[model samples]
Target: MTNRAGRTGTLNEELLRKAATLQEALPYLRRFAGEVFVIKYGGHAMGDDTLAKAFAENIVLLKQVGIHPVIVHGGGPQIGRMLERLKIHSQFVDGLRVTDRETVDIVEMVLSGSINKQIVSAIQLAGGMAIGLSGKDGALIQARKLTRSKADPDSNIERILDLGFVGEPRHINPDIFNAIDLDAVIPVIAPIGVGKNGETFNINADSAAGAIASALGAAKLIMLTDVAGVLDKDGQLLPVLTPRDVLVLRGEGVITGGMIPKIETCLDAVRNGVGAATILDGRVENVILLETFTEHGVGTMIRRDDPADGEGG
Candidate 1:
């Protein structure tokens, strides 16, 4: 009887603590209320059930608190799996997947339709109304073919090689986004765009999300990735960084390879009017809540201007 009572008392204490935390979050919530927030949802969260639920709950709570959350997800792994099953040999030029016509169709099928719907369904199951959409829907993201050079010099790979339907977003139609009744429904976006020629293309989710956020003048752009954030020379995460800091880190060889494009997306988002771009670790539990509603955020944040250390979370 005594042990049962103790357990009950502990539960009560935890409840009270949660209540206090929620109350404290009210001011932060008010500040972001009615503001658009674009989140690039990928990394481990896209696969893990627990992380997916946590992500869904975070977006739901953001809605409950009056912040409009727009989600753009990347299912590269899924797309790769689908491609493999089709026995299509995929070739990568540079870091980007060389998406030909057939590959583009596969990308659309797996990402825009299937994975996007799954995310929406999951969000809905978590008690949030979610609407799954694609860049082709109402032509939200208008893009053009992106050409790049290959690496095989003997084949004259330096010459501009067309990657077929692969594209980078050139414009965003915010009207499609605004039309969604975000008071209850969350927007789940898949990164696939259509060109003026009525051709469908595969777009990088980071690029799409940044473009969308810039169009919306989103108060925050949160990119959920595998790593914690940009690291310094000592291999420590840079909690805060500016565009100059990014260049500095790059010069020091701390930021290289894949991190470059992601950071570039952040920089572009900020430059294009999004307030801030935060690169967060999707593996961590409740990271979104900690970043948005609490004082100390858990990952790297790229802003136009760095906040004073120990200030302005």
Candidate 2:
């Protein structure tokens, strides 16, 4: 009986390995198959060497499969470290860096010029061709200074404080993006936008990526964060959610805190014509493939409220 059980276990292990191989190949077979995916890379995944290496490998595979993957990255941890080293006191106005002229200079150098190139180099070292870019290159993203604060919805108290040199994405030029022959080349984007004055301002990587996806008519937008996607009140992964479903959750108080804005962004992208918006945990190995290939995708997939979209599929 013991020998029989061992043989069965070996056969099961072989079958499982074959199944995983097939699952990984599905996304590759689909390839660029007329899909554009935007990925926002940040958080602890950026700090861990192993995770970063895994991220690079996954990106290379996406390119190999003919998928037009665009990368937008945040260097918050790097910026924080640099600031600390320079003894510059960091201040935030509603979660935005209060950038003065000096800070803006540092932000541009670290984000667009320095760290951007480093990421490109890493991808190349991983045998993936990559190009580093920013919003200013070829007028990719036009912007204007943002004045943000809590505003009264009742049209009573208008609180608009200058949020330094933060720029809101007014337009996205995907021409430079389309012009590239991205056979195995990836475009690493830094969240820096050009203003009417031709000045570069720090932009939020998440909002910038969402805007780019909408402009490019991307099939999907993926935001890689520390959280394990949207969870139910019981702390279980919700798996699938629609824009309306998110609204109901907000009302029922199932979603609150920092998750509110994140979910709101996901819903907005889904509503604005992107096929889907996914909030995934980058810490997972091969998460990109798991979400795109498997029947049960990883993370929370925020889809349109229109039932017709998935009922038949």
Candidate 3:
């Protein structure tokens, strides 16, 4: 009898915990209703099946609760693997892939065709309506060539490095979104843009997501990355930050490498009218829920206000 009673007690405790979790989420649901959230979905999470399904379900839940979700996905590793299989020599300068004409065609095929459809299928399987499109669709994103300059070690002269077909978003047409019923279907976007003269360009996914978020004036821009948010010098995650804090961290060399671009993207989104931007580790199951519903969010949040304003992560 004691054992049976203990089992019953344990089940009751588990039920109570779940109830508490739902109760905690109620206020967040109320606040975010009818708001738009732009999610940059990628990293190791995309490669894993379980994590991807969890992500899709979380997005569906958000939509059901009246929050619109727009997904911008990256497929760098997938692209690299495909290039290797085809014996195509791929190169990168400052983490931006140098895409030639042939490379750009392959990039478009992978991003807009395979990866994009796969995500759409995943969402559909998770009981959500999803439509996959590229930045080229409906004249969505206009892009321009991205140029970089590096100083020669010996001559001390800066020379331009041509990253062929690699482009940045020059403009975003928010009008295209107006035609779609965001309340019914989620838009999954591939980060490939079209140049003015009908040229195809490969765009960095993080930059693409930021530009879209800025154009939409989304309530939040959530970056799902591989890391555990922004870290301090000692490699601990900092939960909250302001734009000034980001600049300070960059100046201190604490933010470098690939993280630099992600941070810059977040900064750009917020500066361009996004309410807040968060860098989250996508490997954690239901990470989006943890960040949105919980009082103390899991990842690092960047707000426009200073810490002194009492607005934290």
Candidate 4:
């Protein structure tokens, strides 16, 4: 009888712990009710089937709890694989693919046709209504060609490199989002945009997501990357950061390479009226839930001068 009683006690303790977790999440659910969360889903997470399903479940749960989720996805690895299978050689300038006309077509196919629909289907299968969209749809993201300048090391002369069909978002139209029932539907967006001349441009997914988050005045902009958020010099994750902190880190060369642009995107989004922005590791299961509903968040959150805001520890 004592052994049975001990087993029952342990089972009850487990149940109580789960109940406590739910109780802790209740306040956050109330706080984020009817708020929009823009999620940029990419990196290694997209390639993993298990992580993808978990991501879909996370989105559905957020919607079921009255929070709207907008997803922007990237397909760099998939695009490269497609290009290779087709025997199409590609080149990159300053980490931006020099997308010629043919390459841009394939980019659209991979991004809008394959990847976008896959994400939508995942969400739908997870019991949520998901609508896939491109920036060209409803003129959502109006874009212009991106120009990059590189200096010659010998003469120190700057020259602009024309990356054909590679564009940056000039504007985002939030009316398209309003047309859908945000409460009942999730929007999965591809970063392909249309230029003023009616030319299709391949915009960076991070840039497009930032613009969309800013335009919608979203409560949170979450960027899911392979890294475990921003790390300190000793490789410890910085849980919370301000704009000034980010700038200092950049100035000290701690933030470099591709991370620079991602940090800049977060900074721009928060500065342009988004409530907060975060960079987290998507490789972990249920990372979104860990960041949103728990006291101990899993990433680096950047806010505007408000140290009191966001998750701690």
User: Cα RMSDs of all predictions?
Assistant: 2.4, 3.6, 1.6, 1.7
For each candidate, the alpha-carbon lDDT, in order, equals: 0.88, 0.82, 0.92, 0.93
The candidate maximizing lDDT is: 4
Q: For residues 1-313, what per-residue lDDT tens digits would candidate 3 score against the true structure?
A: 4799889999999999999998988888888899999999999999999999999999999999999999999999999999999999999888889999999999999999999999999999999999999999987989999999999999999999999999999999998899999999899999999999999999999999999999998989999999999999998999988888988999999989988888889888888989889999999999999999987888898888654431422
Rate residue 305 of model 1 by lDDT: 62
Error of 4 at 148 (Å): 0.4
Scanning candidate 2 in windows of ten residues, the lowest lDDT window is 304-313
Q: Over the stretch 1-313, how does candidate 2's per-residue lDDT look in tens digits? A: 4699889999999999998878766754564455678898888788788888888888877777677788999988898788888888889866778888788888888888777887788788888899999889988989889877777789868788777888888899878976887555689999999998898788988888888888877778889999899898899999889877888899999889777877877777776787788889988877887787666778988888786542110
Residue-by-residue lDDT tens digits, candidate 4, 1-313: 4799889999999999999989888888998999999999999899999999999999999999999999999999999999999999999987899999999999999999999999999999999999999999999999999999999999999988989999999989888987989988899999999999999999999999999999999999999999999998888999888989988998888888999899999999988988889999999999999999987778999988876654332
Clash pairs for candidate 3: none
Cα error, residue 238 of model 1, in Å, equals 1.0
Give the range where candidate 4 is weakest over 10 consecutive residues by summed lDDT.
304-313
| TM-score of structure candidate 4 | 0.97
Cα deviation in Å at residue 184, candidate 3? Answer: 0.6
lDDT of 3 at 173: 92
Give TM per candidate.
Answer: 0.93, 0.89, 0.97, 0.97
